[model samples]
Target: MVVSPERLAGAPHPLLEGLDAGRAAAPAAVVIFGASGDLTSRKLMPALQALMARQQLAPGTSIVGVGRSDLDHEDFRARMRRAVEQAGDVDERAWAELEGGFRYVSGGYDDGTTYKVLDEVVGDLDRERGTAGNRLHYLSTPPGVFADVVRRLGEVGLHRPALGGEFARVVIEKPFGRDLASAEALDAALHEVLDEDQLYRIDHYLGKETVQNVLALRFANSIFEPVWNRRYVDSVQITVAESEGVGHRAGFYEEAGALRDIVQNHLLQVLALTAMEPPVSMSPQGIRDEKVKALGAVDLLDAAEVSAEVVRARYRGGWVGGAEVPGYLDEDGVAPDSRTETYVAMRLRIDNWRWAGVPFYLRTGKRLPKRMTEVALQFSGVPHLPFAPTQAAELGPNALVLRIQPDEGITLRFGAKVPGQSFDVRSVSMDFSYGAAFLEEAPEAYERLLLDALHGDPTLFIRTDEVRQAWRIVQPLLDAWADDPAPPVDYDAGTWGPEEADRLLAADGRRWRRP
Candidate 1:
């Protein structure tokens, strides 16, 4: 658990100084519950390997993968090696070091005997390696099995640390729930097995470097905060767009539409971060308190409001990336008459003093034009313009954009005079790209999140109250859509979204950004 002074002395960046400040986590066992899933292979395993490569993992750390698959330890290791290879470039030495600690335990979710076997396996690791009774359980399984796994952990006394021992924490992946009632039920079940501090509800989007930079951009700089309120800002648009269809996930998509899969968790979380008041400090609870407040202040929509403010649609067969793709109904495992929505756009208002009059527009979709997630703050135009109308016709309102993916960066757009004697102006962007500014590529989101969980830092992880608040805001819309007999409107696969999405913004005299 002790931080290596030698390692800290060789730190390459100021942001990594925390590594030398005795903040590095102690050796522990990270037991993943759904080890056979794609999430484990694609993200979790690769992240663990990268952390080892960076010497971020403790010397005696171990990973025990628990799943229903019949694979033994060696079989699991081989599969993971291939996964890590596919993820990125791999260092043989680092991969070998991480592989040495890999183990697998095959078992069913509801079998109490399986947990008993797991308890024994974890104890053996504590004795063989210097894990010191510290364990991190990752619930990467389906939501239906979340409660069963938590209860089994509690039943086997795996939710708590051994007497006078180190820590025990659990990391739960989303979707946390399908609706408000389910979310509340899950929260209640979690409380029975583990204390609030011992649980980490992970949303990988929050783990991104750019998303974290949002807080830094707002609080660290003085220029934006003063004018960030309703008085100077016109409207805010947050978009999480993807160009690919559901593909293999069509079965899950059939039951959980875009609303449940994306808007309820990721999109709402981004909105809270964008609109929250500055925290007293950046402590775990300090940041979460402000986020909860912001979410609580969200203007909940009623049935009437839902019809006016929300637009839901499905993607029809059309060319994407210059290739034709199947519509939602044509996807395998999807019902012929499925009503699930692949695209969603909604307008929200915060009922707080700081953002009273301003609107926040949020949208997310699958099978769209491109893969990009960003937050755009469009500033109100100048009240008076001294320039001639013809000279300023091309000028648009100033905007500050925080791009979260693809080209991760911040862009400030403003009017600038063209190269001529005449007073002509055009919109220009001043860009700050992450890749250009830093020499090292940012760590994967899973890497950051896993390290934080091991270090017992929940600042980046969502809290129980935050989850419930997000569900509360989206539940009415879910109900309204369910009660209506009409199916979701349709849009082409390669297009941005349904025409109704445009109308949703046009009604307020605004337009959706081409991005």
Candidate 2:
């Protein structure tokens, strides 16, 4: 059960100086429940391996994977090796060092006896190695099993702080609830065994480099913040589109449509980061407080208002990436008469003075033409246009785009004079590309969240209040969708979305960005 510091290797990165150079605080035992699942293989294990490769992990830190599979340590390590090779870019030396940190145990979610055994195993590791009683329990299992795992950990005394002054933290995966009431229920169940600070609600979006860089882009820059208010900005658009269909997740997608899956959590977080006032400090709670305030001020949609502003659609059979894909109903595990929405486009208005009159258009969908997630801050047009009518008619509005994925970067669009004898103005983009400028690859979202958990930093993780407020903001939309008698419009695959999405923005004389 014990891991030796001498067995570990590699020097740490400059960004991880504080965490890696600290007094090799008591080693940590990270217990990942549902360790045999796809998420664990694709994200969790690879993230942990990346951290260990960077030497950010504390000395003597060990990973204990808990699952229902009857595999030995070597078998578990082999499985994780495949996962790491697929998901991580570990050098040979680093891989050897990280491989030495792996361990495994067989356990079920509802079995308290299994937790008791786990507690004993962890204690033995802590004693043999010098990990000062610090433990992080990551529940990567489904929402249905979260409560059982937490309760079992509590019953086995692993949920509470150790008598020897050790700390305990629990990290839960997303899809907090179906709606406001269910979100509250989920909170109540966890609060039984965990205090507010001891809980880390994982929202991978918060961990992205570009997303975190937003704080610097806004708060650190005086130019942007001055005009970032409702005065200069016309409207904001948040779009997260995917070019792939629901492959094997149709069962989960059926119950949780576009609204719950994307809008409720991911879109809201993006909105908060975009709209929040500057925090006094970058502390976890300080940043979360501002986010909570921003989310709380969001204008909740009423049934009628929601119906008018919202557009939902299901993608019918069509071509995506030059190949044919089945419709939602035809997807595996999808019911024949499914009514779930695969796409959602809605316009939201903030009631605060700073953004009182401005609209924030949010949209997301699957099986689209391209995979792009971006936030566009559309600026107001010139009060008076001096250009000729012919030329003015061909130009679009100015926009500042913050691209989060596919190509993580920032682009600013403005009308510029063309280099010709004739006076001609055309829209030009000033782009700041992440890949071109920074040769090193940015850490995956999971890597950032896992390292933060190890260091007891919750700055990028979602707080309980933030989660509730997010659900509160979108509650009306949920109600409207449930009560609406009309069926969603159908959009073909490999397209932007339903025609209704275009019409939603056309009402304001604006259009979704074509990228």
Candidate 3:
């Protein structure tokens, strides 16, 4: 009972098209490294199943899951089926129909011979199925093996132009690197084998519907873009927080913490889109160019300056939802005396003429009161107070909140007269909710990125320099925090963060937004 590709009479969503184009044009087969990992089962496979159920995959497209698991094609398909069923909303027929596309390759990442086998298997698929020599290489594996996999692919000529065909695109997952230097080194390693354009740096945040709506909201509407500058805007805040702790990722979280895990890539991408200038054209490069420029305009925080503006914290034992939880250090795989920061709050400045003097406060953390990701733009108060002192004081500055998750929507707040009040004013809000208004399931972030990678569109994905610029801004802060022997300030798990975080903004006569 799933929709077929043929039934998608109109243009498929832009995201789906991107995935299809990457597959169809190159006669490419998709090889997902780290095929047996949690990401593959929990996200990647589910996304592909959704694409297939929707009939968006290219004709003759083949998928080869690469992992060390000893599973044949049938076994792989069965595993993938369970994954699809568990992670997605699909009918049995959809699962049955999509199962035919599954395949597997088993080997250790360090073995070069694995790439040789991969080359052979891909060639066999092409010869038997009449698929053109195109391939989309997805590295869903750990960041450690990314360079090795890409290099091996190139060594075996798997990434080279096929017989009478073009090159394959390589897609990567998040936590690109540990820091700026490592990120740059990663770029260099990949560049040795793949051209810049052939790389898709996937940060799933950019794939969200609400995030994409940012572009449409700014460009499609005339009412807001004119005021999206320092002239009328007071400040902008981008936040990505989680209600859950590191959970199973404590090992990974020990090294990454919240900054690299979320801010450096996901949050920065949101900031870029929210602050980027309108591109001359909507082509991938044009849009990306504008974003890169915006990142370049981001002012780096000096050590002393960063210490003043930024605050990092560790979550301590506290009741969350009536259940007691241990502190971050007590999490499994975390060092007994680990100093990794689970929370980060920073006041940032963009040096460009458009956003100069605008204090953009960015923060993200785990084990907070609730899960919420949003971008709030606070506009300047009226130039003059035209009402009584009490009435005027009651009016808060206009705020445009773009709720990016949990409840995807846009809300505008303005002052209004309270009913039956003695000329008293109160803040009133008008909202556009995606769920209530559209009543449709928004495509998952991975679904959108998967489609875009298939379609060979790099616009929604981050470019190398964009990644570098983001790291550049945070590298200094990381260095300063490392140099300091002091541990991160501790906060109760259920609360927002440490008191210093409050004072980081309070000193400026401002406060962090509360839900």
Candidate 4:
């Protein structure tokens, strides 16, 4: 069901006309370090097959699974095949093209022999399967082992492409680091074994169709460009809410909390895409340069401002989706005295020529009422109104909402005149749904990210500067919470968040949207 832009037959894609749609994946051997893990089965495996179905993966491309699961080549192939079949439709010829070169290396990441065997397998693929001495290494292992694995590859001389015009890249999964110091440390560790251009720091949120559509909506359409500034916009609210609690990731959540888990990477990346100015070109560096600038423009809040503008809370036990769920402390593997925060809300300002005084409010949490991610910008109200106050009392300011998931659409909301002898106005929405507008369903986020990585495009991935600025912006909050051992305030699982979050908005006379 995944369709590439080039596969639109004789028609051109309106949104991707001038921008980089990226080329088909070149011939290379994709090496997954944690092939037996949940991420491999749930996302990576399906994504690779989806690319093959869409014919984006080149013919000489092969797959190599490296894990300690005690699975041989046949066993790994069977497991991956079942995963792909369950995901969606599969092209027989595409499977045949890749199945013969499937190889598995069973060993530990810290051991030396793992790389020795991996190097042999890759060499064989290059000579026998026409892989062209190119490689795409994916680090799906735990964060603790990321450095060791990459270093091992370097020791075995597998860090760079051996042939001319061949590409070699590494795709790193997120939760990049705990804070600013750790993020810099990780960057230093990676640079020792790989160049900046060879590393892909992927954040799946950036790969979403709606997220990428932000560029086309703002740059391709002239209606949005002139008004997308502080002069016309009052405030921007971005939300990433979840209805379910952390069911299986309690151990990781206890260490990361909401700040590192969501804010540092996912939410901040989305913020950059929404707030950034138009790039000079759609090339990888051009887009990345603007994103880094947008994030760099954010004013780092001081400790006093941190306490006043940010709200962090934990979820207490309550009914969710008609079922009762336990509180965060009651969850398995969580400490009874844990000070970890499950929800966070903060109001931020970008100090620059375009967004000098406008506030960008961002919040993310689990165990909320419903699952949703969106960016809503409300325009300033008219200075004067001719109608009576009562007639327009129900009308609200115009808003443009970009729904990233669930509904997966764009909504333009404005006041519409009521059909009656007496004039009245109420807000109505003009919606654009991807399903209703296109004949093909959009690809999964991982699918697009994987293809981009294979094609050596880092536009949708995070840059080092962007990551550093994100950590710098959140470091003050980290220090404040570290100095105090006080537990975060608690709210019911089914509620939006604590009343304290509302006060954060109330201070500015703005409120969180119900959506």
Off by over 4 Å in 1: 1-23
lDDT of 1 by residue, 450-469 (tens): 99998888988999999999
Angstrom error of the Cα, residue 130, model 1: value is 1.2
Question: What is the overall TM-score of model 3 with all chains considered together?
Answer: 0.93
**Global Cα lDDT for candidate 3:** 0.84
Model 4 segments more than 4 A misplaced: 1-23
Report the candidate with higher lDDT, 2 versus 3: 3
In model 3, how many backbone clashes occur? 8
**How close to the true structure is residue 444 of candidate 2, measured as C-alpha lDDT?**
85
Q: What is the per-residue lDDT of model 2 for residues 83-182, given as tens digits with 9 covering 90 to 100?
A: 8888746566657755666678787779877788788878877776655677899998889888889988989789865657468999999889788999
For each candidate, C-alpha RMSD in Å?
A: 3.9, 6.0, 4.7, 3.6
Which model is ahead, 1 or 4, in terms of lDDT?
Answer: 1
Sorted by lDDT (best first), the order is 1, 4, 3, 2
For residue 461, model 1's alpha carbon misses the true position, in angstroms, by 0.4
Task: Point out where model 2 deviates above 4 Å.
Answer: 1-26, 88-92, 98-101, 163-165
29-119: candidate 3 lDDT, tens digit per residue: 7899988889988998888777766766754667898877888888888888788778857656556655556678888876888888888
Better of 1 and 3 by TM-score: 1
